[model samples]
Target: MGMVLVSHSQARVRTHDKCAPLLPLPMMLQRNVLSDSAPILLSILLLFQNLTISSNQSDGSDGEVLLKFKASLDNPAALDTWAGPTAPCSGWKGVLCGQGRVWGLQLEGMGLHGAIDVETLAQLPGLRSLSFKNNDFEGALPNLTRHRSLKTVYLSNNKFSGEISDWAFSGMNSLKKLHLENNKFSGTIPATLTTAPRLIELALQDNVFEGEIPNFEQEGLKNFNVSNNRLVGQIPRSLSRLDASSFSGNDDLCGEPLEACPANYDGPTKYDYHDDRIRHHKFPETTIAVVAILLGAALIALLGVCIFLICRKKKSHQETAPAATAAAAAAPATEDLNQMERGGESAAPGGSEGGKPSVRLLTFLKEDSEKFDMQELLRASAEVLGGGVFGSTYKAGLNGKKMVVKRFKHMNQVSKEEFNEHMRRLGRMSHRNVQPIVAFYYKKEEKLLVTAFAENVSLAARLHGNQMSDHQSLDWTTRLKIVKGVAKGLLYLHNELPSLTPAHGHLKASNVLLDAAFTPLLTDYGLIPIINKEQAEESMVAYKSPEYKETGKLTKKTDVWCFGYLILEILTRKDSGVEQQADVDLATWVETAVANESSGYVAGAAVFDQEMAGGRHSQVEMMKLLRIGLSCCEADVEKRPEMKDVAEKVEEIKEREFDDDFYSSYASESDMLSSRGLSEDFRSINI
Candidate 1:
């Protein structure tokens, strides 16, 4: 949506007039404000210094992750340049982070190579942006659907092959920019994928797609590309307006701006050419045969004409056919819709194909169409409630049978195959505090995920004042237990188990599904990364790392920062505990917090009251955790920690809390169920 008009800067007629193109753009914008070159160099140096500092300090407990990432970079010089001391995170090249995590990992055109594993990157929860353009990467793309906060994914100019399958991008609904141009992929483009609501740019040119182009009409696509493929036949006119370049280079492709095949070349050129040869090679014999047949046909026709005339005359003499004969001879009972159009009645619109319409009947019919029944879902939900991202406190039910229904929003951006893959993956996930997905449905493009909905609100809900006043809120001991339980879940995702693929990419309070026993169940664990294509850029501003605003790359440390933020949100029932802008770095808050700790510095009392008050954890401990978050949000990748260390420290913190009496008070009575509601279930899936 933002527009930047760039031209040469040298032809400066005057300050009010347009400048010539030869002058530098940076100089043109700053010339009037500054008279010397020293300031510009200083500013540039500061920026670089900030990057170095961010890279060095990011991901407090995940520095191992950074080291591994740095080792994979093509240009090791970048590591030396940006990983030095005294450098500021803002000055780092291709590094961005917020609240202490590595959020953006844009190393475009750095000549990065070597085999890459997506699992290494998945460790960073706070990552929301990634870019690896113009590289020598090979093999299939890494699965990034777990990073819930991700918004931009740029992986163009690589050596990726195979068909673009739905499983590759299972939950990337919040993704706004997906650039996969200039690859070596083949096979038909999945029809269900083109309808992402948040998508703005789609560049799939120079691939080998061979089927009908999927529908891209409804998406907010400002740019599209499908050229240089094996695609044949007429291009969809709906996409014709984009640009000729988008559909150019396919020899078999025709129609729209491209020229159509010549009208003369009809009925397969080979057939006509062969027939013409037959006409020419046997001309004499064919001519004689035609003459003889014409003579014979003339004699026969004369005789037939005489007979027909006699019959016609006799028929004319006879009376008109009887009504009974006419009735008996009426056309067969097969439907003649064209005749019906002229006289027969038209049934009412929206009626069932079998009979009259009713809400109950329609619901029943829709259920029958699926592999399950409707009434069974209503009865189970009356007994339990659950919660996740879209909101808090959703009730479950089943009409009569022992079914479970968990209501959710139709995040219509998810494609059918992607949703199914995500559900299957989620279903297989084994964790004490994570709910497994069963099945989901999408009707009219609305996405609803059916999971084993837990029976209670998250601990954050209680902290945020969601429970009844007399309901006896969680005591400090119970809160500590809850933290430990959640920490265990995080540890499992971060380490503990060697994952075959990435785990939860997004960690947020709203995603913390809770059972009646107060056990934290992380719902939508892997959905965040996949649903990145769901909303606009603005909608993701809150959850996205500061680095994402500049270069889009999600690092393991980014997840660390998000986990830290989740920790804050849990402790303080709020999402905006810290906010960082693209232009103004997150380090500002870090520096302020650090400065206030000095003896002579004047501390902001409000910040102190909110961040360090009451019988909560000691300021040193809180600051340690905050620093961990800040380190993870550091603008540099090399500075972040590995999840193993973070999980260790989190475990330590939780173990210390379990000794309190509050840990003994948690309720424990909920049984996990598989399927939820039917209509609500069917209407929400996007396949």
Candidate 2:
């Protein structure tokens, strides 16, 4: 719709039709002001501007703009609080207000998705910060370059894919702290991102970026990461001082903080080199003696080079000769690998060759898993599931069954034979509580793991994403079952894969899936062997264990400590995404909350999810479970109970209504105090 204009002196200003693009008010007024009969109209327009400015706030224009923006999301209910007559600055959720206007929208993990309406956001002239971190928003980012006034932008942990246009960040002058980590955004990182004069803290990890990095000149840049991507070439010198973890997960990247680049390497260069400059230089062969001397020196140098090459080749051959036999069963013939890369549709999923191994690169680990060839998987219609610290995950359909394909960028910790052997070992695991590996694909740049999709989604989604939807929140019984099952799964992993450190290395709510019956099954297990050491240390939940964090030590109890964090999340229904600056996790929060317990279980009750807190016995059971969790999470590592003990404690605590006689699982109050550091706070409360 076009803007309306009225002139007391014979109104004749033409208005564009609805289909036409709207022009800025100044441009619209300029067209009318320059007209032959417009001196009177121009003077009246000035009076109109004055009147418009006065009614702006009362007109509810900014709130209306946000409403339209909310409507554009696939799940608008995520922002239900953004509705109504209440001023956006006063009551709307996530709308940051200052100086009586909307300046920021900090929506994180509200389960919102779909492309945002950039035009609607543009209406708020005072807008500065925009955060959509940990949401499900997909598609290429909006035309956000126009939002030059923006300071910080967080699109991390979303499904936004494809290469951003080079001009996308060209006009973002005020930009800083751009976090596009944990997404499927591909192609070379936009060089125009350097245009932002205030740029800092650029996080581009867990993506599909390729080619050389841009020469970032911003002096203020402190936090940066391009790890877990398809990036190649030397990192920019400006970012070399950062920890090696920042550049992990990229196999081809080289230079300081990593390995040294080749001496003749021309950075970001596409052409082949052919150097012959030495031939053009004139030799100072003024005398026959000088010529003879030069000839003798050249001959001696050539002889030395030949001797070194012969020795190196002999040494390399001796070393590799033994590896050849050991690696024989690990990979297929070179021809077979080339054929697979060429998308040879000659073979079906399990059609003899998908199983063809370093011993089969495209091995179907499970005998019963549905088969598809390399070509089929490559061509399958896929949906982005989510991006994690490891890499991007997708839901792909094959043979009428849904399968999850998780891409990992840094599964290069071991040789190909060792990797295949480890995958086989993990595949043989047949536990009820563990998610089975359906199939796997191996390539130099990345690796893919496939498994059956769980219908109930992840435990994290049940506890968080669907809380506002029609889906009911998981009650105490279900939460208890999940933790029990997770504990059982850990027990199996430890018993079956005794060699693997912590057995289940990446335990978290998101990694735990729920079946139709609400049974918890663990996935992404035993991956510490393949993950890059630096990356695993930096991002994996197991690495966040108390002993590892404090002393750079990893014990058998490291996974138990991670399990404790999971218990805290399930009980409290609260989890802090790493994106948050506070860095306080659920375990720490529970520790602090329970530490301040006064009178009785009053403080401890506050830590549990309000929905699940009720019934005298249930409260007691929660306290008991809280104790178990804290004990498993104990910082001493020595005090933490074994997985068998933890599982037994969980099993001992059952629903109070069914059992005629209920008793505390521990031997005595003093026993609980000694077992867990968090138990002392609850001693005053008689449960």
Candidate 3:
């Protein structure tokens, strides 16, 4: 039997054997050739149609995710390239496409505002890098656990706050760099962050995190920080290898790099020791009785001596009263006669003729000047520079020499001996960065410090004050050098005087005077020890750390915090303003700018000094400096890097700038050579 076949669109057509028997087999075979391949052809067409549908579905899903993300923005004008019905894979801004799907979304520094649409953006199956740095994005962090393929999540410099969920980073095993610095994030750092086995860098500085730092001993973890936070307790032993700056700002923290924990200290405890049995056992009966008898005998002897001294002082006062009155009446006339003859120099006033208080010039260095008295200081030509937290400062000229004199306004609690000790300590410090106290005057009514006058302006004046027409504005290179110099000076103070005044308790831009060569000279060092706590607080209000507010004590970390703020001030040229205006601080302003910039807009540029715009500085390099600045200003003091680390980082930035310049020049020279047909010679020189 023979069969006949025919073709219909996508359907098979065959003739039965009964019908086929009527036709010749060779004729049917020749007629059925077209029909023979119908099934295979139809199969190919159907397969192609299914593939088209699948592709359309994927494209539609990606488009929907992107649209939803755009809809979430508070300002969409910055993302004009993302408009229209064009597919994201075709050429959307910040959207990278690969393998027929969205591969990356790098919209950093965009003026995008509002909360991020993390769920919608996570729908893109191939998305690897999502950067929202320097944006105005607010609200709690979105759930990113489902985005398993994300490698880099840069959400720094934002207003994102609230405690991050413990499971926030659970599924992000592929993440390498997670930068959340300069944000308002609060609460303890998630332990889940340590679970991310592949994380290379983690920056959580400038947040409000509390509690002990979690152990991040992972082999791959290289860079980490939690500085300027309210974190307490010892730094994790695993992290002890990091620089002291990394844990600088947390006042309550203690460990090897910082002040060691006291021997009896067992962390924060609620209960006091009031047990009778334990007290009695510690102090045996015989020892306690012997100590009590000795104390009583000492008290009796002290009382007897007080009576004898009081009687003798009364009799002496009665006898000396007449002579003191006669001396007081004649002192002014005698001083006027002496001043007229000695050309304004006279004996110090307010003392008796025979018992005049002698003026002593205590100095750490050898004194070459003739014996000078307090009368010389009073007679010197003096101009009031300004009043500061410590006291009023004066520029004085005496014997053709200029010096800065600071008269203490609120150091009454410090005695003569204590003031002398402080002056000697400061005089002994001869570091190039620290301003040495050349001489000091101690009296019942006044305490004064004398230091060499810096010929150039202070850092504060250079940054915030009006510029002179003849003087050039500080370029990026100069600014960087100043910052590095300041860091070095602070490091020297912290390292050399860790036991005395480990931190510059009153570090401010105004106190950082620049010498003729632009070298930073730290002033107001070692003042915290001599000033009362109340005075210290009032004087250092602008530079005080958050922990200082609560504990009323300053640490090395506090100085780190102040330095961080100073860096921001230098970069932005904005006054920290009054403490009443919390949002006006350079830190908050910088953080906001950083957040706005992360979304692919240039919002962060708003905080930079306008003059910096004309310089040859790279925006990328500026951003790196901003990050470093923000890290120093971290709310977690323990997470702040030491001044040494900061100096090194700044040095690294300078080196990076040099490298960039070198490469750029090299490339330009190469291009010029290529145009001139001398590229072969240039290439040969490389060999």
lDDT of 2 by residue, 11-42 (tens): 22233343468765855795778775687887
- Model 2, CA-based lDDT: 0.73
Clashing residue pairs, backbone N/CA/C < 3 A, model 2:
329-359, 330-358, 330-359, 331-358, 331-359, 349-371, 349-372, 356-360, 357-360
Top candidate by TM-score: 2
lDDT of 3 by residue, 1-687 (tens): 111212221122243533555544433443465467666655665566556644664577888888888987888778888866677866788887776688788888886788788888878888898888988888898789879889988899988999897658864668889999898887778766765657888888888877667667455677887888767777777788788887778777888678888888776432111222542457779989999999999999999999999889877866697867666544532343234224343344534443233443434332543344454565566667677665677776778877776777677787775576556545656688888777777765556777888977688877766755546567666777788888888888776555443457777788899888888899988777677767666666423577666665556677767777777787788776534446567777766555554433232555678665422235445644666676777665566666666666665554234332211111111211111122122112120
lDDT of 1 by residue, 2-63 (tens): 12222123223354364445644444435543556567675775566566555556654444
Ranking by lDDT: 2, 3, 1
Work out the TM-score per prediction.
Answer: 0.39, 0.46, 0.45
- Give candidate 2's TM-score: 0.46
Q: Which order, best to worst by TM-score?
A: 2, 3, 1
Model with the higher TM-score, candidate 2 or 3: 2
